[model samples]
Target chain A: MECYSELTCSLFVDGELTGDAARHLRDHLVTCQRCRDLVHALRAESRVLTESLRELPEEAPSPEAFSHLGFSWVWGDLAMMAAVLALGSTLFIWIDHLEIPGALEWFNPFSLNGLTNLMFNLSYYFAHGGTAMLTEYVAVVGGLFLVLLLGGSVLLLGRRWRLPKNGLGLLIVLLTFSLPGFALERRHEEFVTIAANQTVDDTLLAIGNTVRVEGVVNGDLLAFGRSVEVSGTVKGDLVSFAKRTVVSGSVEGRIYNFSQSLDLDGQLGHSIYGFTQSLRVADRGHVGDGIVAAAGDVSLEGEVKRSVDMLLSGNADLSGSIGRDMTVTGRGLTLTNTARVGGNLTARVRQLKGVHIADGAIIAGKRDVQVRVRKSQFARSRFYFRQALSFASAMLVGWLGLVLVPGFFRETTQAVGSGWRSLGLGIGILAGVPVAIVVVAITLVGIPIALMLFAAYLTAIYLAKIWVGAFLGWILLRPTGATRYDWLLGLLLGLLILTIVGFIPYLGGLVRFGIVCLGLGAFAWQLYHASRPAMTA
Target chain B: MIVEVEEGVVVEATSSEPSPLGAVIRMEERAQLRVAIAHLPENYRLPLVLRYYSELSYDEIAQQLGLRRNHVAVLILRAKQELRRKLAHRSK
Candidate 1:
């Protein structure tokens, strides 16, 4: 019979052999000294190995462990997100109909698509209330933002890229140009022209000289010459400062005027107020509320449905109807035959002429008239008080995150920013190879090398985005001192400055694409560096 | 206890003699020891000297392992031989 092998001994130990077969293996062990010794050694080694395994660390020991945020790490997070979303949705759906007032409102009965819209609208509704609602809105928005940011970060960080030296050099040049103060003045214009008829959005539409509108602007309008006319309807408010300002069309909202002469010929759906040097209103125009002004000459040929308080240097003309009250302090006053003062009229005028008041003109309040010839008794003496209520809502999810996962934010931020280059490089490599292969196949030998180089370049894009995302997240979260906040705010003032300003057809695309490439390159460098050691590990 | 064919009384009866029945009994004993050792975990490692002394006679192991006679003699005379014997006997 053959000698019992180590394999046979192992099988016997595992109780594979039965009855006499097992007995036979057992019999061999009584004589074979070498086999016995080998088994003994193997047994001792196994025990030690098992014990050592028990002592392995539960978590990554070093901070540098986070220096390489890989797919597995992010996949774990994604899984958590999916779980939480599921739980939240389920809880909301189950308990929403129970009428738990405060929380119940969040449970919209609408379809899933409608729920998003509802949530958006509900947030806007709460936006009007005090800081509490604003706070809640910010919190929700910040959370949504973070999830998206992290998702993108993961994708970007995992990429890699390579490019030709010249391409790299060009990227560097573009990055240098992207810095502030590289070129300050973007577009030069004292007066910009808007065509006679064109549709414009919220963008700064240029037309004529020295015409400024700070109202709830709707569509586009034409501006021409020294006279500034807003004849077209404005869905939003209108704010203008001009030599002579005219609003012939309807203003759905408030109108703030800073001009030498102000004229409102059309109806104002809301209030109209101004601070001007000279104010004039044609007979066809009207004022929705009281008019406050400091001017040289104040003339109103139209109707004032409410009150009017004016201070003028030369003269004041009133041919319009005053519904409530009229107060004027000017050098001279003139009331035409068409003037009908429904309410009291208080004035300080040097001379009064053509003072015509129809017998039927109702004057409910006491009427007093005073001629103030002195130049010092101007309208600047009166100040209209306004309530100053400031609103600041910062949606801090970090505090929440700190409550939930103490180290998640800091760790994630470090992982994203520090490793941005390597991560981007990884992604570029992952994406580039297949794309390059496809290109190579299509173009044959003509593009194989080029495709390879392009693949290298693309692999670095995610690195750039990861770094930018981390910086943006940090900047957005930093509760630095007031001055730091101010500085940061100032720094971010141009978040989309290039986008808005660079929309000049072909040049815009070039500039933006160039900027994008530079950003991608920088991130790619960071991600590439970050990802290397991780790959080795 | 004192049954012997040649010169010495067989102590501990670790293996059977040259008879057919003795060979079967010796094979069974050898297999038992192997089973015990094989049951241990994969990472475990026993001391080589202890294992060899407990499992094999000095002359047989010396021949197989290419060790000198004096070395095996010395290993058996030392406390290592006694420790292995006691451990094996206790385990069984």
Candidate 2:
């Protein structure tokens, strides 16, 4: 503690040290001039290095992102499904043997070879024995399932006690890892149930009026019934087509729900693709690849590993974790303070004011209105209020963008120096790109390519003003004669200027349009110049 | 370890060392550093790339690499040390 450690210095440089340690170090450095200087030097060094690294701009969208999600990804799940079936039949015969040592004992009934032969026969049945073996095993699995379900339901329902969610989730994760098979329940009248204690070896198809899965299904679960309740563990895809679907268990695969109302209070192994009148993914829910939810009032209180695409008529209340992009087409959207979206948010909301995006809701990606972008209703002087809000929002976004990837902003802003050239390039690109896209789309084969280019074009257009703002910020801050550019201040002043001027009438609109063209031109100029040498090389 | 060589060879190659905190954030420098990093051992490379380029936290890097969370920090520290050494060596 006498001398500040280099390890601490490194962590400090990375801004990782928090709370007491950071506080202590800062206090210590106050009296210790030498250490203060050292810390300063390290900060400077790391800042420069980080800035350079950021500029490397490695977060470029991968070409693979454009590729269609193909069937190749599900091949592993299918193979696992086949294996589960083989194991389930053996379990059935073993349980049957335990109950009655003589009844249905076709092999050498007392020996290990007898058990081995029984399993071998089950495998033969899985491969060639057909529907008979499947039907026979389902009866056994279904029987045990009912027994366990009834027992648990009686005890738990009687006590009015629910199992702890975390423990249940962990238990399901462990149980579902062991088996994979196809469980067939084609009863037209009976309410089919897969118990909590039961483990289905493979894919499950429960076709009944009301289906309840409370067991651990080792394979995919496909239930087509009036009401479906899944409280069990399905290690594969959970596909339900029912009037009301309630998933209160863990699914170690994608969930495809098509129902009137869908309630998810479980952990999803992969993504969710659902169409429902109303959907609620509860706080305890966790989805791996995000969700493609087309519902009425979708209330998401869960963690999504990727993005969320919501097509909803009613309100969307989101207070969860999103790993990437979130696109919403809804009447209203509300993001609680606890909500964190790691990537961009594009909302096509009917009214902007109804979309209550609270403080502490971290959206790492750009928050832009894709379609039907409207100014929120301001209680004060509507024109001035909107401008002020725009300035503040844009400034915050610009600062965060710079902090996240300084290189991108740095490069874009650099183009502003060649003012006329950049403006020319931007105009050319803005005009030419649409035509190119249209021509490409006509080919049909190049549709994806055209769409991708269009997306890029839109992004560039959106960012065009940002470059102009940054440039203006730079010029304003230049007189400070500081070596490094004060980009934050530049961005703020520029955004304020842009926003305030936008409050003007027809002239303001014309001015904004001119700025867009100029900004786009500059960006294109930079891109062209930047890529030329590399392309030639 | 190679300070003597750095003083004699690399010192002459560059006009002078930058101010402790005043290294210009240059694209060329990034390219040079990246090229230098490409020469590092595979074990060091992934952690460095993920830590800096990808901006992954220690826990995330650990999970992706299937290493213990604490181990990721250790790897990052070692990787930086090695990177600095290699950059100096390449400069020579």
Residue A533's lDDT in candidate 1: 21
Model 1 spans with C-alpha error above 4 angstroms:
A1-197, A201-207, A210-216, A219-225, A351-364, A373-537, B1-92
TM-score of 2: 0.32
Write candidate 1's Cα lDDT for A498-519 as tens digits.
Answer: 4344456798776545444444
Please write out the lDDT profile of model 1 over residues B17-55, one tens digit for every residue.
336676565455444433333222211212222223123
* lDDT on C-alpha atoms for all candidate structures: 0.47, 0.65
RMSD of 2: 25.8
- Give me the candidate number with maximum lDDT: 2
lDDT by residue (A1-537, candidate 2, tens digit) is 486776676676566778998988888898898788777766554544454455544321221221221232245235434444444355446544433222123212334544555566688887886655543343333333323322332333322223246646744653454222212433333477877777777667665668898988876777766788888888888878678888888888898887888888888889889988998888998888888988899988988889899999898888988999989998888899999889998888877776899998989989986445455534447767666776676777677668785755676687677777776555555555664454333221234545666898887777777778878777876646522347777777776677668658898897687678778877655553333112110
Model 2 alpha-carbon miss at residue A269, Å: 0.2
Q: How many angstroms is residue A370 displaced in model 2 relative to the true structure, after the best TM-score fit?
A: 5.6
Model 1 score (lDDT): 0.47
lDDT tens digits by residue: candidate 2, B1-92: 11223223533433365543334434456666655555455567566666675666767768777888667766767777787787777779
